[model samples]
Target: MLSGIRIVEICGIGPGPFCAMHLADLGADVIAVEREAAAGAPSSLLNRGKRSIVADLKTPEGRELVLKLIEDADALIEGMRPGVMERLGLGPAECAARNPRLVYGRMTGWGQTGPLAQAAGHDNNYIATSGALYYNGTPAEPPQSAITLIGDIGGGALYLAVGLLAGILKARETGQGTVVDASIVDGSAHMMQLILASRQKGLVTGPRGENMHERSHFFATYRCADGHFITLGSLEPQFYALLLEKLGLRDDPRFAGKQWDRARWGEMQAHFTELFASRTRDEWSALLEGTDVCFGPVLSPPEAAAHPHMAARDIYFERDGLLQTRPAPRFDGQAVTPRPLPQRGEHTGAILAALDAQAASVWG
Candidate 1:
């Protein structure tokens, strides 16, 4: 869908590379810029489909080269703190001045103008400020440090990509560009939109794990006899009834007429704990494979790859003896093929040649 779009990715860690990867996957012509020494290593799975070039932005000549590339680019993406780009003489103002149609995207943990914009932080710090950390983990324990997936990839990369695409489209129409300030903390807070609405309407409780979805026996994870876990998400009454029937607890008087009654929640949870522990996870999975009971066995990464449904969907693929996930949402009746990731600066000469060709034509 992004066939003719051109993206210049300033190499950094985490979310910036991920956002560029998504653009490349969607058929964008993405060129990644890395420091010279950072090249020559094996490419990472996330760097697939991108051509790489080495440019030391600290040097006047290298910074000038980057400016030249930006002049012809549809979009430029960077993951750096607020003033870092300005200090390096490659901030949005400089880039946008050279190319009025450039969509300049900045990705950071805090927003560009916030008090904490210049502070050092990571995914955990960002999610903590957004209230996302508060709802994580068990009811009795402190909020657990979550996997970086939510804050870094979900809130940071995905939102930055969306913002960049939107800005590019607008620039195409208006003949002017805009800057996208995509902050992980802001994005994480935005992700809690639905939960905030629920809280405002008095439907959600003040404390963690006291809410219906968080605390209810019908919508949580339970341990099985083998210490493996299963998750149940029977949110509706019909689904809840199906889960009870599948677990052979339909006729149990302790669970009768008190499904959502908060007063009886403790008793109901205890009953569910004991009942779920009676069977192994595999045994439970076999019994509830295709039912509307809304049941699934908790699977680790390797186990998820071998799952029958995942295999059928071709969710994971192996490339050059490396195991990696395929790009999401098949398109145009064509399965997205996995391209081998590129080593840093592998395409530097080719990219420079193309740029020189364009410059010669313009000069002529």
Candidate 2:
């Protein structure tokens, strides 16, 4: 869908590269500018489908080379500390000067302006500060989040991608540029709006696991006989009824008609815990895998890849001995086939040749 768009990504770790990879998957011509020293480093899945060029940004000529590239690019993205891009002379203002229609995207854990803006932090630190981590884990334990998934990928990269696309749209119509400051803290906090909105219904009250989502027996994870886990999300009335029927508890006084009796939830959950442990995960799956029970066994990445539905859809595949998932949000009922990962600086010669520029002119 982004066939004609061009994105210039200043090479950085984590969400910045992920965003560029996503755009490239959507048919954008993405050029990743790598530091000269990183020419022969280990391969990164984040570099998939992107062309690579190496340069030393510290030199005036190197910065000028990128600025010239930006002059013809639709968007430029960089993940650096608050003032690093400005110091390197590749900040939004400079890029916009060269191309007034550019969308300059900045990604960070904290924002470009904040108390901890210049401090070193990562995914966990950002989400923890955003209050999105408050309800995670049990009430008895400190919050623990999935590494990098919530903050970096969900909050940072996804938001940056949306912001860049939106800015590009506006720039094309208005003949003006935009600077998108996509901070993980801000995006993660914003992502909590759904749970926060539950507060209006008195569902998100109390502390931690005391809330509706974490406290209910029907909406939690259970460990089975084989030490594997399964999840249940029988939230609606009909689904809860079907779950009780499948477990042969439909006529039991404790659960027959008391799905919302908060007073009995602890007792119900304890009973469920002991009952689910009597069978292996697959055994339980056999009894209730596809119905209104809203059930699923917990699966690792490889197991998920081999699952019937996922395999039927061809969602995951192996490449270079590494597990990888296909590009998401398919268009016109088709999944995007990912291109091969480019070797570091593999396109340097051709890219420079296209510009009619020499390496020494930029490297010096």
Candidate 3:
């Protein structure tokens, strides 16, 4: 969908390349600038669908090469610490001077102007500081998050991609460029608004485990006979009723009370734990998988990739001796075929020659 849009990505780690990859998957022409020393380095899955060039940003000539690319580009993405790009003479102001309508996207953990902006940090630190991590795990344990998903991919990369696109839209309309400060801290906090709204409604009151989402047996994970896990989200009254009916517990006095009865949750949970353990995950799936029980088996990566629904949708595939996912938010009711991973600096000479040719034509 972004077929003609050109983006210049200053290669960094994590979210920056990920955002560029999403754009590339949508058909953007993304040129990833790498360090000269990184030439022929092992390619990353994130480098898929992107062309690569190597230059030393510390040198004047190297910085100029990137600037030249920016001259006709729609956006520039950088994930450096605040002021690092400025020091390299390739910051927003310089790039905007070359292409007035460029969208400058800055991805970082702490954002551009906060006290912690210049401080070094990572995915976990950003979400922790944002208060989004407070309610992740069980109350008995320290809050644990899935690695890099919440803060890095969801908050950091996804937010930056949206910001860059929005900025590109605005620039196209007004012919004026803007800088997008896409910070994981800010984005993760913003993502907490749903839970915060529930809190305001008193549905999420009390201590961590005592909250409605946590305190109920109807909204938790249970272990089966085979030691595999399954989840239940029978939050609504009818769904809870269906779950009890499926388990042959509809008439049992222990589970017959209000679904949110905090006083009975411990006893109810104990009963459920014993009951679910009577059957293996597959057995339970046979009984309740498609009803109003709001049930799902907790699957590992490979298990999920091979599941019936996932395989039917072709969501995951093996490519280049690695597992890869198709581009998301699919268009035209079709999955976007992932492009090949580019070898590091594979297009450096060809890209430079194109630049030289463009300059020659302009001068002629």
The whole-model lDDT of each prediction reads 0.86, 0.91, 0.91
Where does candidate 2 have its weakest 10-residue lDDT segment?
355-364
Q: What value of lDDT does candidate 2 attain over all alpha carbons?
A: 0.91
TM-score for all models, in order of appearance: 0.96, 0.96, 0.97
Model 3: residues >4 Å from true position, as ranges?
Answer: none
Q: lDDT tens string, model 1, 120-152? A: 998998999988788877788778765778799
lDDT of 3 at 188: 96
Which is superior by lDDT, 1 or 2?
Answer: 2
Among all windows of ten consecutive residues in candidate 3, which has the lowest summed lDDT?
A: 34-43
Clashing pairs in model 2? none
lDDT per residue (tens digit) for residues 244-343 in model 3? 8898889987787667778888888888889899999999888988888999999998998998989999999998679888999887789889789988
lDDT of 2 by residue, 310-364 (tens): 9989999998898999999998999778998999889988998877654456676
